[model samples]
Target: MTLMLCSVAAAASAHAGELPRLRTEDGRHALLVDGKPYLMLGAQVHNSSNYPSVLPQVWPVMQALSANTIEIPVAWEQFEPTEGRFDYSWVDTLLAQARKNDMRVVLLWFGSWKNGDSTYTPEWVKSDTKRFPRLQKRDGRPTTTLSPLGEATLAADRKAFVALMRHLREVDREHTVIMVQVENEIGSHGVARDYSPAAERLFAQQVPEDIRRASGKQSGTWAEVFGKEADQAFAAWTYARFVQEVAVAGKAEKNLPLYTNAAVFDATGTAMAAQVASGGPNWNVLPIWKTAAPALDLIGPDLYLPLEKTYLGLLDRYARPDNALFVPETSNAIWAVRFFWAALGRGAIGWAPFGMDATSYSNYPLGARKLDPATIEAFAAPYRLFRPIARDWAAIASKHPTWGTAKNSAGEDSTSMGSWKISVTYGRNNFDIPWPGMEPPPWAKEPVGGGVVAQLGPNEFLVAGQYSRFQFMPVDPAVNGQIMSAEEGTFIDGRWQASRRWNGDQISYGFNFNEQPALLRVKLSTY
Candidate 1:
C-alpha cells in the first residue's frame, strides 16, 4: 500500500484519475485514499451533533483529540425536510468545516434507520404510515422500526442518498468525504423480523435462491431452511437488500466506498443477541448480508461492549479474508486505546470512538457521550504519536507482521510476531538512567501503557509504546542475536528524524517506555 497525497487545488483530479479503493494483500486489508495508503485516526460526533451550531463544538473537540478524520451524520430529515425540495446546506457546511479543519469526513446517512428506529425519517414520511409503513411485530402492531418491505421508504431513501452523493461530487472536489455509512444500526429492536403483510408473504414463500446458494442449502421455505434462526435470517436478507439499493444509487453518482455499521451482538450467550439489535448483519448472519448486499464495500461493527474479550473477538470475526476490518463506532473509554492497537495488529483499516465531543446529546451510550480530559488524552496520545509516521505505518503494517498488548498487571506479558519476541513488563522504575536506591514512581503503580510493534525487516523493527518496558529478543533460541543499535526518533513526512542514541544504560536492561510516547527504530544482528 502506497500513500498518495491529493493537492488542495486539484483534489478532484485524484478522484478522477483514481478514486479511493480498498485492496487486500496477503489476506490483510488496506484503504488507499487518493492513491496512498491511509490510516484513519478518527472520532465520531454525537447523533445530533452535526447541526450547524453544534458542529462548532465538534471541530474543536476533534482538534483537541488530534483526529485526522471525523464521522458525522447527514440525517434524512435534515437533508430532505420536505417531500421533494432538497437542502444541501447542512452537507455543504459539514464539508466546508472538515476542509477548513484539514480533516477528512465519513458522512453517516441517518435514512430509514437510526439505531433500530425510523425517528430520523422525515416528518412527512413518518406521519403517513400507509405510504411509508413501519415494521410490524409478531402481534401485527406497528413498531418504530422502518419496514424494508415498503417500496415508498426504499425509494425515498435511495433518492435522498443519491442526491447527497451528487451534491458531494459538486462541492467535495477535494474528496474531503472519503466514505459514507449507508444507515445507522439498521434492524428491528422489539421483534426478530418484521411481521408486516408484505414481509409475511415473502417469508412464507420459498427462501430467496441467492441466499440459499450462499448458505449452501437446498430449496426450502424460510423456516425450513434456517429453522430456529429463520426470523433473524429473513430480517437480515430484507435489510441488506434495502441497503444495497440505497448504496447502489449513491455509488452511481459518486463512486466512493460505502458501508453499514452493525450494533454488535455477542456470539457468546453471555449477552442476549436478539435483544441487542436483530435483523442487521450480526456475526452469525454476516454471510447472508454479504450475498444479499454485494454493492456494500464493507460491513463494520459498532463495538460498544466494554469487555476485553468481546472487543477483541469482534475484531477477529470481522477481519475475514473476504471482508475488511473497520470499527466505525466504539465507546470513548480509556481502555479503547488498547483495542485500537489490537485492531491495527489485526489489520483493521480504521477505528473510531463514537460521541467523542466534550458534550452529551440524548441517550447515546454514556461512555461515548460525555468525554473527560483524561479520556481525550487517552485517545489523543496514540493519534499524536502516530500522525507523522501514520502514512508509512499504513503502507507496511499489513504486509509485515504486527502485534500489540496493553499493560497487564496480572503478570508479565509477551507477543511473538515476525522474527522477534517482544516481552512487556509493567510498573518499572526509571532504568534509562542509573539511579542508585531509587524506587518505582507512583505513576508506575497503575500506568496506562500499551503499544504496537511492526516488523519492518528480518533484523529491523519499528516500535512505539508508553508506560511499560519492552525487551526484544529472537523468537528462535537457535538464532543468536544482540541489539546492534536503538535510535529513538520521529518520522517526519515518512522520513526518519533520529534525535537520541540509546547505548550504555539507556537500553541496558530494556526500553523504559514511560507516559511520554516515542517511536523507535531498532536494529538487531545475529552472530
Candidate 2:
C-alpha cells in the first residue's frame, strides 16, 4: 500500500484536486486538473500487465513517455486462478512502484475480455464448463465465451471484481486508479455473437426497448434493428449487457471513471458495421451500450492501421464531446511523431505506441510495418528523453490539440527515409528547426533535458533537450514571429531545405515569437 502522486511540480504546484476530469477549451478537449486542462502523453508497455518481473525494465519505458498514467490489466486467472483464491501481490507491487515514480494508472479488468476471448478465466471457471457458458460457432460448436448467462461465472466475476473494487476503496480511495477499463478489446471471434442456449433465449425475446429507444433506433425485432443483419447488432447488445453487469459491480464502490476499448478494423460503415451487427461496439450500438452500461464513461479505439490519414480520421470520428479522444494503443513508427503532435494539438486525452518494452528488435503490429532509417531516427529523437519529452509534450497535447499543431516547410527539396513508405516534408535548407532532420534515433542523440519539447506560440516553446537551436522563417504574419532576416526554402514531402539565407539574426529578438518551438528566443513581431 504505497502512494502514487501523478503530477509535475510545474503543473502540480498550482492545482489542488483529488482526481482529474476531462474538459473542453478553445475548441479542444483536455483532461482538467484543478479545473485546468491537463495533457496526457503516454505509451502502452509491451505485456507490462502480465509480467511483474519485466516491470523494472518496462517502467523505464513508461517513464520515458512522460505518461501521466499507465494502462495495466489485472487478469482473472492470474489473480484468482482457483475459485475463491485471490492474489493481489502483483498489482500491489505495481501500485507501490507507481507511487515511487509518482505516476497514476488506469487498470484494465481482464475478467471476460482480452482480445475478445475469456482466455484469462481462472482454472476453476475454465475447467468447469457447466457453470460458465461458451459461445457457439456458425456450425454450433462452442466458441470462446464465459456464458453470458452462467450464474456461477457471472457471480464469481462480480464477487471477485466487487472485492477488488472494495479493496481499491480501502487502499486507493484517493483515486490513484483514476479509471478502469471494464475489459480489454471486448468482442467475440470465430463467432458473430454468442449463440449459447441462454444467449439464444435472450435474443429470441422482444427487443429491450430501453436499448432500442436509447438508440432512437428504428426497432422491431433483432432482425429490424438494422435490416437483414439486425441479429448481429442484437447479439452484440446482449454481450454488452453482460459486460455492463460486471462493470456496475466494480464501479458501485468507487465512482472512478470507467471505459471499454474497441479493436477497430475500419471506419467505413461496412467495417464497423460487422463489429456492431455481430455484437461489437459499433457506433449504432453505442446508444445500446449507453443504456446497458450506464456506468461505463467512455469507449475508445485501438488503432494499428498503416493508413495514417484514415487511422487518425477514425480517431476524429469517435472523438466527441461526450466521448473523449483517447487512443489506447498503436504501433511505434516515425509518423507517430507527427500523429502524436497532431493528437496533442487536437486535444487527445491519451496516446500510446505499443511495445514499450526493452526489446530493441521491435514488435509492432502488421499495419505498422516498413520503418526506414529516417523514420527510426524520427522516433529516436523522443526516446533520448522519453519521460520528460512525453510529459512536456503530452501536457500540451492532452490539453490543447490545436496548440501542438504547426505547419512548417521541409528543409530540402527531397528527403526520404531508406525503407519508409512515407517521406518528411520541409522547406529548403535542412536546418534543425524548419527542416525535418535525417533519421536520428532517440537512442542515438543523447537528450540533456527531462521532458520532451515542442513549440507553442510564434517563437515560444519549452525544451526537454539541452543546448539545441533550430531555424525557421516567417510565413503568415499571424503565426511567424520576428526573425533576423528571410531564409527561402520549400518542403518536398516531409523534409525541408533552405536555398537562401537572409540576415535577421540582428533583429531576431523575442518580439514576434511567443511560444513557437523553432523560433525560440527569436521574436516574431506583427509586421
* CA lDDT, every model vs. true structure: 0.81, 0.56
Tens digit of lDDT per residue, candidate 1, span 49-151? 8788888778888998889889999999999999898999888888888889999899999999999889898999999999998888888999887799999
Q: Candidate 2: how many backbone clashes? A: 81
Off by over 4 Å in 2: 1-17, 23-28, 32-36, 271-278, 359-364, 367-527
Separately for all candidates shown, the number of backbone clashes (residues 3 or more apart, or on different chains) is 4, 81
Best by lDDT: 1
lDDT of 2 by residue, 107-184 (tens): 778886677778887877877776676777656788667645677777788888887787788787445676677777
After TM-score superposition, what is the CA distance of residue 237 in candidate 2 from its true location, in Å? 1.3
